[model samples]
Target: MSASTHWLATASIQSVLERGGNAFDAAVAGAFVLHVVEPHLNGPGGDMTGIFATADRPGEPVVLMGQGPAPAAATTEHYRAEGLELVPGAGALASAVPGAVDAWLLLLRDHGTWPLADVLAYAVGYARQGHQILPRVRDTIATVAELFTDHWPSSAAHWMPDGEVPGDDALLRNEPYAAVLDQLVGAAEGTAGGPDPTGTAAGRRTAGIEAARDLWARLVGREAEAFLARPHRHSSGTDHAGVLSAADVEGFRACYEPSATVSFRGHTIAKTGPWGQGPALLLTLAILEGFDDEYLDPSTELGAHTILEAQKLAIADRESYFGDTDVPLGHLLSTEYSAERRRLITESASHEFRPGTVPGHPPFIPPLRVDYTPPAAATGAKTGFAGIGEPTVQPDGETRGDTCHLDVVDRWGNMVSATPSGGWLQSSPLVPALGFCLGTRLQMTWLEDGAPSTLTPGKRPRTTLTPTLVLKDGQAVSALGSPGGDQQDQWQLLYLLRTIVGGYSPQQAIDAPALHTTSIPGSFWPRTWTPGGAVVEDRLGQEVIAGLEARGHVVTRAGDWALGRLSAVVRDPATGQLAAAANPRGVQGYAAGR
Candidate 1:
């Protein structure tokens, strides 16, 4: 079974699985297709993080550490010298080493059954033979049309041929990206020496995969370095050259690591470490575990209030402590610390940014700017471009430039949940040679010194691309994830509560209305917070919404289906039954299986 944010990706996964590929292979195929079909949401120049449990090791959850660190020259001093206070949200200067391709390739080399050529054929076909452009993709192009035409002409040439934005559902093709894939495949085959005359087939496959990885690093990195080194317009409304070099890209490699886990409702929930925001979900679950089942319900007013409060507390800690530095995760996840944090959740909403005190560790309090107005110089008289950041939910619940998610569970108990994001067409100027842009992941880092998430050379910015894996009875049971920035885990929290605590099935849980608190500091650029703010879908009911508002939550109604874009695939080890569910909100996501 497979579920993904886009129908094409889900269809690709179905085809791969039907062709004797395992969950890993299906996921890789679907992910590459996403880069082609959902270019506004993700691309080859992006980053991704996944958690999976192999069929041979069902009990152990492994995190695919695909997030890249800052470049060696990405120093806070250099950025400050450029007369910048914050990392620009959409430029090469905000790029980390591109890691999504390397990570997916690593997974394919280590665990997949299909060859690289077969896996990439799905994406190559879509990129060369064209796919229907999504309305959102077209809309995003229109929004940034001026930016492309005036400053990033390469982007204008790619997205808007002859200075015209393509209409929705227009057939779009990326021949450059398709050619890039062909080159990778040809290079890999040539370097592998025609299937290795003396070595085994497995040996040849590994060799080919490694050759592809090396070629990607060499080709993409060199082109990106040359393109971004030229001065370009940034979200800050400044023209600055990027700092990422070929060495930065060549030095990074994606690898697997043990997942950070916390037991909740007799289920082991797995996530990436503190380098990403995955641990914040675990911390929220730990805090909520002390509450009664009734309070965990997401349908009622009381349950909504409790969940929002818990998320705020957990996200506060995330803002203060989560990064690529040493974090006191042991104490944060301890029962005593959870109890202490739980005691602070009052009946009413909290308008304050409160991170609990940890022993011998002082919380680094970030600047809390409630309202942000760009300077006239920064705005450049550009109306729509001001305050643009990741495609995340705004304070008023509006969204743009969102992420993509996919989940696959095969009959063999192999399961994977992956969230691929960044490198939106609007992220940076198009790297003309690669037909893609570098991601702005470095915007998650602070320019301020001493913060755990501060922009430091060679250290990863705390990312929000989180995926989840659930295990029960020493066997992997489900893999799930979504694509909201800071709200990623918040939306998934509702799904987890509905399924694990409310006894709702996967589809039932996904169909339910969703809500997330925005009271905490945002991880994106123009970092700000909304005090006592919460955004909820109107389908959650007026009574519940009014109850939250009465409890002092500054609520924003996001229509009936505007909050989450989640999907999941589940397996029952005892019965060998499999199921999949995808969000119906956007009318795009789908689940496929037989």
Candidate 2:
């Protein structure tokens, strides 16, 4: 092996690991740096979610819980009361207490090997020096340049270095953000607060609710007051507010619980509530487990197209019915997500889309039932492995934001992957002088009325951000994930299936183009009134496309590689070899340590 072993990722995370910090620490640093380097992809404005397993560390791979609190401020009736067409983006509502920093602190407190200063340095240097805008970064800006320009002044300044959004090759710079990073680092460390960084009257403590509450936050020093004055405006295509304040920033806090739901291999693995989607992932898997590959394979094609349809069915359920377990929405078929119910649904799924509207088909209501009271029977096919008892109680509702990720493995058998972001920097409005985006993830639920994910006071928007790790025999096998909204979990799933079940190496898996199903209903059995539809390109092997057409999939071909960009690192335990790969398509980046 070369003197060091690393793979594709933002600079900060790699630097941490290179200096001896493990994946966890490196991941934290990488995420922070991403806030500055790829501001559009993530920052402190959104929520965070991730899971990891380490051979160098102890315990069954732990899930780093980071879904921020349901806004104590956005009440259920608030949405109804506000004549606002949908969830309001008022400054107070647009921002959630940022969890990325808190999550970073918790990770370091538990698994990190580096000090806060050490990790912050990577982001600091990148911000201060400013790198030339690479094609990938520039292209990403172009994708949502209009969105950023629509809201945050900082975004326009960053993306439009030349008064207009600069294309690739322009020397990009954000000195103001770098200055903010310096102060945030100082604040976290308690140094810049006018000689009493820990806020013992030595600091201003005059602005920002969250900042004043925590003595350590004084490290933000002189800039803290200025930082809080600006508010976050909504960045959705339409309908937004921008009244942010100092108290709001000071009041921000990250929430966590011991036992929310979690899952693995198509079953709710072991988890409980407060954290979002962990159980839902398992629920989808549980329902899928009932069908043997024989049934699944013959039922669908072998190409990416085949899996696309099945995945669409699962995601559709998630889009409409899934919500914070606290929602009080009744179960779909008795105790919601029961095994017997799943088998029945599966049996009918094959007959779905058989052309004519058949009377015997399972009704279209199960998947769409928002108020799933327990009248639905409970059975094994769907009842997942009983969830592990939760260890802590957390807040209800959820958070929205963006993040960044990177993973690496070395010759000595050390491997790591890190994803960090809780806000979409480029897509949301920047707090004028603070230099970061207040994520607008709440816009995900835009239905006219009563959508589960629709914005409510304190409720978190549905997310596509799930960082993941793959293991074999209780040892770390590989690490992978991305910053795509809502696309995060699906991308990881598609890549994992490609790597393990398809016999492809991790590189092959990361390199492959991907597809996704819509949040819609199905035409065949059980007649799922899905939230969306699934579209497979007419390519990716003729056989796969033919099968979908036969089964009646409404296909829409995307770019050669459409779903999202993917990056990963894999190591075979026995051989001690490392493989790293990155998606070279539109969502771009490169890899190393081959």
- Whole-model Cα lDDT per candidate? 0.91, 0.47
TM agreement with the true structure for every prediction: 0.98, 0.71
Residue 434 accuracy (lDDT) in model 2: 56
Tens digit per residue, CA lDDT, model 2, 488-559: 555666676665555577667666656555444321111123232344333454666565555555545554
Q: Write the per-residue lDDT of candidate 1 for residues 101-212, one digit (tens) a residue.
A: 9999999999998988999999999999999999888878887888899999999999998689998768989999999999889877876667576578888888888889
Total backbone collisions, model 2: 70
Question: Among all windows of ten consecutive residues in candidate 2, which has the lowest summed lDDT?
Answer: 385-394
Global Cα lDDT for candidate 2: 0.47
The per-prediction CA RMSD against the true structure, in angstroms, equals 1.5, 11.0
Candidate 2 Cα outliers beyond 4 Å, as residue runs = 1-12, 54-59, 76-82, 88-93, 136-154, 188-240, 243-248, 255-274, 294-309, 327-403, 408-418, 445-459, 521-532, 537-539, 571-579
- Per-residue error for 267 in candidate 2, Å, reads 11
